[model samples]
Each structure stands twice: as C-alpha cells, then as structure tokens.
Target chain A: MHEEPLVRWDWIGRNWPNIQVLLEDHVVMSLVPIVVGLLVALPLGLACVRWRWLYQPTVGVMNVVYSLPSLAVFIVLIPVTGLATRTTVMIPLTFYAMAVLIPAVVDGLTAVPDHVRQSAVAMGFTPLRRLLRVELPIAVPVVLAGLRVAAVSSISLVSVGALVGRGGLGYLFIDGWQRQFYTPIIVGIVLVVLLAAVADMLLVLAQRLLTPWSRARGSA
Target chain B: MVAGEGVGVNWLIDFFGDPANWSGPDGIPVRLLEHLQFSALSLLLAVLIALPLGLWIGHTGKGALFAVLSANAARALPTLGLLVLIVLLMGVGTDIPVLIPLVALAVPPILVNTYEGIRGVDPELRDAAYGMGLRGGQVLGRVLVPVALPLILLGLRIAAIQVVSTATVAAYVGLGGLGRFIIDGLATKDFPRTIGGAVLVALLALAVQLGFTFIQRLVVSPGVSERQAVR
Candidate 1:
C-alpha cells in the first residue's frame, strides 16, 4: 500500500471552505458559553458573596459538575436537547465555563479591600452603583484570569462535541481517524490550539488595558 | 412521544437491572476495569514526569517562567484532538497512543499546582529549616513538601478525575472501557446503554473526587488543612 503523507496540503487547499465553516462553528460555540457563563456567574457570584453561607455549597456543586466527563454530559443531554444540535454541545460547555468563572467573580469581588468598600459607602454610592462602578472594575484582572482559563478550556472542549456530530473542528478528528487520514486530525488540533492561544492573548490584552493599575501594583 | 420517552427511561433502568450485563468479557465489570487501568497508568506516567520537574522548578525557582508557559500551552491543547492525532500518527495497534494524550492531559494540572504549592511556601519556614542545619534535600523534604502537600494532593485529584472522565475516548479507537457502552450504544442508537454509561462515568468521577477529599483529610496536617479551609 502506498503510504499517505503526514499532511496533504492539496487536500487542505481543496477543503479550505469546509474547514473555514468548522473553524467558525468552533469559535461561536466556544465564545457563546463564555459570554453566557459570565452573565450567569456574575449574578450567582454576587449572591454567593452576599449570603456568605451560599459560597461553599455553590462551589462544591460546581466542582462536582465540572468533574463529570464532557462526553457523558453531551450524551445525557441528548434526550433533552436532541443529538447533533449545537445546543446539546453548548449547554455542558456553559456549565464548565461557569465552574471556572464563578470562582473568578467571587474571588475578584472579595479581593476588593474593606477600605475601598467603606469609601464607596462614605461617598453615598448606592450598592448597585458601588458594585458597578467600583467593585467590578477592581475585579477585572482576576475575572480576566478566570476568563482566560474558561476560554481556553471551552475551546478545547468544544471538540468533544464532535462525538455527538457537532464538534465543530472536532469533527475533523473523527473524520480523519475513521478514514486513517491525517489532514483533518492535524488541522483540527492546530486550529483548536491556535484558537485557544488567540483567545487567551485577547483576554490578557483586555486585562492589561482594563487594569493598567494592576500591572503597576504587580510589579511593585 | 412521551410514552416512547418513558419506555426509554425504563429500558435504561432495565439495562442496569439485568444480571446478564454484570459478568463476562463484555460486561460492565470488565469495562470498568479497563477504564480504571487506563486512568491509573496514565496518571502514574504523568506524575512521574511532572512531579520531579515541578519540584525542581519549585525548589530552585529556575525555569519557573518556562514551566508556567508550557503548562498553559498544554492546557490549551484539546484532548480529543490530541488523542485522534496520536492514533493517526502511531497507527493505533497498542495502547500507547491512547496513553500519550491521557498523560498529556493530566500533566499540566499536576505540574502547575505542584510548582505553585512549593513556591507559595513561606520564606520564613525555609529559612528556619535551613537554620536547623538541614541540607537542601532535607529542607525540601521536611519543610516544603509537607507544607505543599495539600495543593499537591489537590493537583493529583484534579488530574485523576480528568483522566477518568476523558478515558472514555479510549473506546472511540477500539479500546475497551466503560466508554464502550457510550460509543457502541450511540452507534447503535441504544439510549439505555448510552445513558447508563454516562451515569457510570459521572459516578466514577464523583467517587474519585470524594476519595481525594477523604485522603486530603486523612493525610494533610490539621493545621495545614484548617488553614486551607479558611482560605
């Protein structure tokens, strides 16, 4: 049998359009979860901080949810969400994002010094205004750090959805493996890793821009 | 449709209720064992490689930048992609291809946590240990390792859980494990087997989590453990 090369540039050139679609699907699937999770986590994290008692139990439950295999979660959701659907994949990814983001949100909020809060109060700032204008801005660096992890992991994990027929770039892995071809598999891995790197870099840039004071403090 | 869904749920229960599914080469027990074997072996390999490197970087503080950067890079590599890529590259006759990705997946958490744990130790404690005339190895073993034990254990627990969960991918490439139920069932459209497999995987992951929590309580010093809890 004539051996296939590790990569076929010709195959990629021909399949560029399909690959682009998968790459776009991968990006959307990965990004939506982080956005949705941050929205959900912000409220939940605030509630956890407010209640104090709720914090430990919320974290405990989230940890358990995080440990469940992504594949299993996708399969289990098949009944509710149907198979080969983007929703089935995105739901589990959202939970995983929340698992990371909630802690980031909470830790970011908690790290705001007591004196900072007191000054906000002394300045006649409403609780909502204080949180919006003061606490959340301070929490940007920590929250961005969490966002980095969540984004990277979510991008990587969206590939597992390929098992259920919606894995975005992950579909390439299954396709390549089933045919014993290397192009799709290699393409998938590279794109996923690159996507993660790009997303992480963007978040780091956002942190630097949003929290310039943090870099000064960090260096000091 | 509702009635059909009810039947599906019942079949899932019956899948577990059947004694015939409990034994033999194709049974749950055999699959469970394969899953654990894959997880355990991969974890062992990961720890052997990561632990020493983490310790060296942590203790000496050299290459700390390199370690953190590489670990983060590893984190971003999709496990499914790595698994398939290795299988394609190695031609998938042995279990080595599967083990490579599993170990790769497990390494970053263990390495980062171990390094952070050691580096997080107070300088005062290190100085006190050195002041007692303890050699470098002795200070690391006696002072640093004990203090860093909780985080190290936490890393192992995270790695173990991840390995167990991801081990399901083994069945994708014709290896036997609990994931067999998932992949086979999904292929055959057997909802019972699929859900049952997912339940088992989730349960196993939870057991691993609880097992680590128990071990942490048993082994971590009361002072260190309590301090961690407070944090």
Candidate 2:
C-alpha cells in the first residue's frame, strides 16, 4: 500500500491526454448545472428579500430540496426523465447547488452592513441599484464561499450520474469496484480529489483576484 | 410542468399502501429502515470516538494542529471514493459503506468544536486553577470540558446531519438501507416512491438538526457563545 504510483514519465505519456479529456468533460458537466442553478436560485434568493412572505416558505421548500439525498434524487429522476442526458445530470445537480446557494445568498445579502445600505438610501439609489452596487459587492465573498463548497460537491457528485450512463470519473470507480480492481479506481479517486483541490484553489484565487480587499481584510 | 406518468409513480403509492414491502428479496421499506439503522449505528460509533478524542486533543494544547488537519482532510476526501476503496479491501456487504461514509461525514465539526471549546476556556481561569494547584484531570473535568461542551455538541449536530444525508449512499455497496428504495424507485422510474425517500431523508435531517439545536440550548450556557469567536 505504501508503494504509490507517482505519475512516472511513461505513465504520464500514456495517460495524460486521456486524463485531460476526461477532466475537461467532468468540469463541464459539473459546472454547467451549477451556473444554471445560480441563475435560478440567485434571483429567487433576492426576491425573498424584496417580498417578505416569500422568504420563509421559499427557503423552506429549497431546504427540503437541499436535504434530499443525492441518490434518491437521481433515482427519482430516472423514471420521469429516463437514463443519461444533460437533464438527468443537471436537474439534480441544480437542486444540490440550490440547497447550499439559496441560504448563503440570502444570508450574504442580509449581512451587508447597515451603513452601506444607509449610504445607498441617502444617495437615493433604487432597491435594485443598491442591491447591484453596494449589497452584492459586499456579499460576494460569502456568496462565493458557498459556491465553492457546492462546486466541489457537485463535481464529485456528477459521478453518481455515471451509474446511469452519464460517463464521468464515477464510471472508473464503479467499474473498478465491480471487478475488484484498484489502479483505475484509485486513479479515479485521486482525480476527483485533485479536481476538488483545483476547484477550491480556483475559488480561493477568484476571491483574491475579484475582491482584492479580501486578503487585506483577512490579515487585518 | 408535466404531470407524473412516465415512470408509473402510482405503483410506488400502491406498494406503500400495501404491507408486502417488508419481505423483500430486498423489501423496500424494510431495507430503508435497515439502512437508517446502519447509519444510526455507525454515527453513534463515530460520535463516541470523535467527541472524546476531539476533547482530549483540543485541551492538550499541542494536539490542535493535528486535529485541524485531520478534520480538513476528512471533509475534503470524497465519500464515494473512500467507500469503493473500503469495499475493495473488505468485500462489501454492509460495514464498509455504512461506516466509511459515516465517519468521513463526521470528523470535521466534532474536531473543530472540541478545539474551539478547549481554547475558549478562560486563560485567567487556567492560571487561577494553577495558582490553587489544580491537577490536569481536575482542570479538564471542571473547567475545560464544560466550557467546550456547547461547541462539542454543535460539532456532533453537524456530523449527525451529514451522516444521515450520506448514509443514503450505502446501497452502492449492496447494503439494504433507504437507498435501496431510491434505487428501486429510480429503476422503476416511480417518482412518488423516489420522491418519498428523498422527502424522508430531508425530514430526518431537518428533525435531527432541530433536535440537536434544542439540545445545544441545554448543553451550552449563555456565556459559552460569547466566546465562540475565540478560535
């Protein structure tokens, strides 16, 4: 077990191209749904703030959606949607992101300091304008933090779709499990972990790049 | 959008209405109850191990670094990959899937909370104890652990919730759990049954979270949260 495969020259020559292609496809499948979910959930989260009654009931429903087991969601979708396609892959993935995103977005927007909102109000900014310029800019980091968590989770989860023939790293893991093989399975596992690390790192980088002030805020 | 028809969602309703689901070659509800039992058993085991160890490491002063790393790694590692590795070694039936993911889901919150509680203990209280010549055991029992109780409880709550959610993945190992209902529902394309399992898992998580929060109100004193920002 201690004797590990360290991506030797020969191994890299043979596997790197395949790995690259596999990873690219995996990233796309994972991200596409995330983007879609954000498009839907973000507006809804904002709408919760605008319409008071919608907050509790809207969040409550999304919470239920969020808490549903990933497998259960996938299985349920199979019958109505049938086996693999973007719909099968995206719908459940969207729900998964929704669970994390909705609350985070709401909390983030709410966390925008009172003074910031006051300044906007004093300046006669409309609710939508205040949200875009002041509220959202401040909340962006916390919102992104939630996205970071969901992004990594969704990427790993896309594999479950593979069991239904979506084709991703999960195929390798499941394949290896049935045959009792370790190499390909380990390869898939390592790749997923690497994918998570890369995704997390990208988020970290974005936090730094997009909010140059965040690093200063952290240290100070 | 479209009303349910393609997967014959009604069979599931019919199945649930009938009592025959309990005697499966893999009986649906029976398998689900068994799955919950498995998750509960493993989560109980994990909380037992993690809580004390977390407390010990957090209070020890020198142990927090390792605890943080362990928690981070536990959170980051993919549960599915971990289960697959375990099934390879153990040749799956029940244990690998149930225990592996349960533990993976748990470690972070437990470890972090324990550390927070320990570190949150008053520095002056520690000096006062030393000035009065208190022993390490007495300090841990009287001062450190109680102060940390709320955070440790919080950690347990988080781990518990994740365990419930992750346990649904156990069916991949051929273990009978609620996951089996989901698997069957998916195979048959029965929306209500599939949705039924999903709703139940969601409810279970919500119920557990609420129960734990209610319990936290009892374990953690008002003073403890004032210092929650310490670590």
True contacts kept of 2: 0.46
Model 2 TM-score, 2 decimals = 0.79
lDDT of each: 0.89, 0.72
Docking class of 1: medium
lDDT of 2 by residue, B1-231 (tens): 255453346645665665666576566557656766876787777777777787777667777878876765665566666677776666566575457667766777787778877887789987787778889888888778877777777677667767776677656666666766665666676545666665556666777777876787766667866766321
- For model 1, residues B1-231, the per-residue Cα lDDT tens digits are 576567658867877998877999878999899898889999999999989988889999998997788778877887787887887687678888788888988888899889999999999999999999999999988889889999899889989988997799667887678999999999998888888898889899999999988888898888887776522
Error of 1 at A75 (Å): 0.6
**Least well predicted 10-residue stretch by lDDT in candidate 2 chain B:** B1-10
Flag clash pairs in model 1: A162-A167
Q: In DockQ, how does model 2 score against the reference complex?
A: 0.41
Residue B86's lDDT in candidate 1? 81
Query: How does residue B68 of candidate 1 score in lDDT?
Result: 87
